[model samples]
Target: MSSAPVETVLVAGATGGTGRAVMRLAQSRVDTLRVLTRSSDAAADLRAAGADEVIVADLLNPEGLSAAVEGVDAVLSAVGTAPTAIPSGPPFVDGAGNRALVAAAADAGVDAFVMESAVGVGPEPSSPLATAFDAFIGPLQEAKAAAEAAIRDAPLRHTILRPGVLTNGSRTDLVTVADPGAKLWGVISRADVARLMLAAPTTPAAHNRTFEVVSKPRFPARNVSIDWTLP
Candidate 1:
């Protein structure tokens, strides 16, 4: 990691849905923002959105990924392929492209790696959503599992957050998840996931852990504080 009060961050696929939120939130906490995108149009948008530098790169190109990640304090991977119209196939992004990002982030000596995963990626599809996920998003889910495993086993501080049904909504910041699997039922705002990605780099407790997240159900939404235990 770079020796500075604040650090630079490299975000791949910065123009995508999840990545955009990561960028929007992370830019406020870091000194330098390095956004990686395939299209120049997105690059301009990233630059205007406060990215210190926008690098045109391809994840498939190891050299490009390595270059993009160099001299960064942390890596927040918001990269994934949305489930296609067709049914699932063999593991997709997780096998190669996702692995490349992990490899590159590790090689670049990143201080921390925060990534997003599905709620039931590993552990034998304990929930019903796992079965449905495997049927519709099998390839990508498998890919995410493999990618997560790669990061977890690496010699870097890693936090893998599995959020339930991503909804594009406001950032409530408050969320909860439990291990027994009952807590997996709910939707989480993408904005909050973005907050977690930015917050994870700064929270030492989030290191070397994988956990699920979901927004709290609201009705009598009072000033009731909730305890969030990050794994």
Candidate 2:
């Protein structure tokens, strides 16, 4: 059996590559597509991108997020931070920003929360490429790890997808989802990840699970099925 798609979905980081894909795909699935943006200048563009409503709020600001998430059925967060040197002040968006969003979503009683995470942040063994990325952006990875932990501890049904080497290619629809520690490394299009993230809330098999996703027919396939059927 399958569940119906949620009525409303709030897409955080709606202007980013993956977030744009989520917003585009969500147009026909959910009843309302709400997009959150840090800049009001993005409002017009987000609306043209098929967002039913654009809520201008920074995920870094916890106090302003309540109204953005209010009454939404699910939240798909593609928020992330660029690599920066270790800081003396507040944490980057990967950690504190996502944590704040989770808090707001929980307080608003959102049903499902899905986040885009890196493959190397969890307990998974790192690939050579992943290793180098970590070395370059170690701080961001650490922050993402913290955010993942916070999502796990929160009182929300969540799906965390750890994708390797994001690309701007088109959606292939042929994808493989495996354990986080499966040690798989490959490039996956942002469109494909967006498809899975949007489907996660309604896909019972995806709830509360963290997995590494890669385009299929690539290296290190675990060759196991986990019921990825979408509603």
Candidate 3:
């Protein structure tokens, strides 16, 4: 199948770390880059950072998101709240907010939807590290799982990237994408994750796939091929 060009990408949660990175990287690649942010205060900064346009809209409002999704070829969602935060808790932001985004994307007939999730979200964690992380963020993990389910059941082509513990470190460019049941665990920079989000739409192996990602030290030989059919 021929991959579609990512001309205009609407990034939800464009004020966050991963979202910022996505905007920075996307500026050079795509013709138009738009962002959905809750604050108008962020518009100037986002535009300075290469966003062609910024829409001030809350993800929690489905009606607002409908307008935000217009004319975008794809939607990249990096929205999530801190585990300790209340009101803007996981149930609302991660679960309901993401669900709204997915529904709007489907309605708008977007070519693709790429979402950022966590490593320990499914029925069980594939690695010991993920299990420990899950124990730390129980409710948050459940919310992410619910959000993943919503995307999986949506009509648009989707790519769900579940990254291990996120860090502030620089990008390693040495990423490993693991299947659902694979025991993959490690720390990855938010910038690297943003790279994957930007690349997902054009990657044939990434469409309608969920994978775990982690950055590793440079190996003797690199294996960049993604096993799309891996179980």
Best of the candidates, lDDT: 2
Question: Which of the numbered candidates is closest to the native, going by highest TM-score?
Answer: 2
Model 3 per-residue lDDT tens digits across residues 107-202:
988889999998888985478877986888777778889989999999988999988888877866678877776667778899889889988888
The local distance difference test score of each candidate is 0.71, 0.85, 0.82
Error of 1 at 126 (Å): 2.9
- Descending-lDDT candidate ranking: 2, 3, 1
Structural similarity to truth (TM-score) of each candidate: 0.85, 0.92, 0.91
Residues 1-231 of candidate 2 have per-residue lDDT tens digits of: 345469999999888999999988999878899999999998998998899999988777767899889999899999877555455535787889999999999999998899999878865687776687688778888888999999999999999998988999999977778877777678899999999999888888788889888884465447346655443
Clashing residue pairs in candidate 1, if any?
94-143
Clashes of each: 1, 0, 0
Cα shift from native, residue 139, model 1 (Å): 0.9
lDDT string for model 1 (66-108, tens) is: 7788888878888777666225554354455668888888887
Which residue window of length 10 is worst by lDDT in model 2? 222-231
lDDT of 1 at 198: 71
Looking at model 2, how many pairs of residues clash? 0
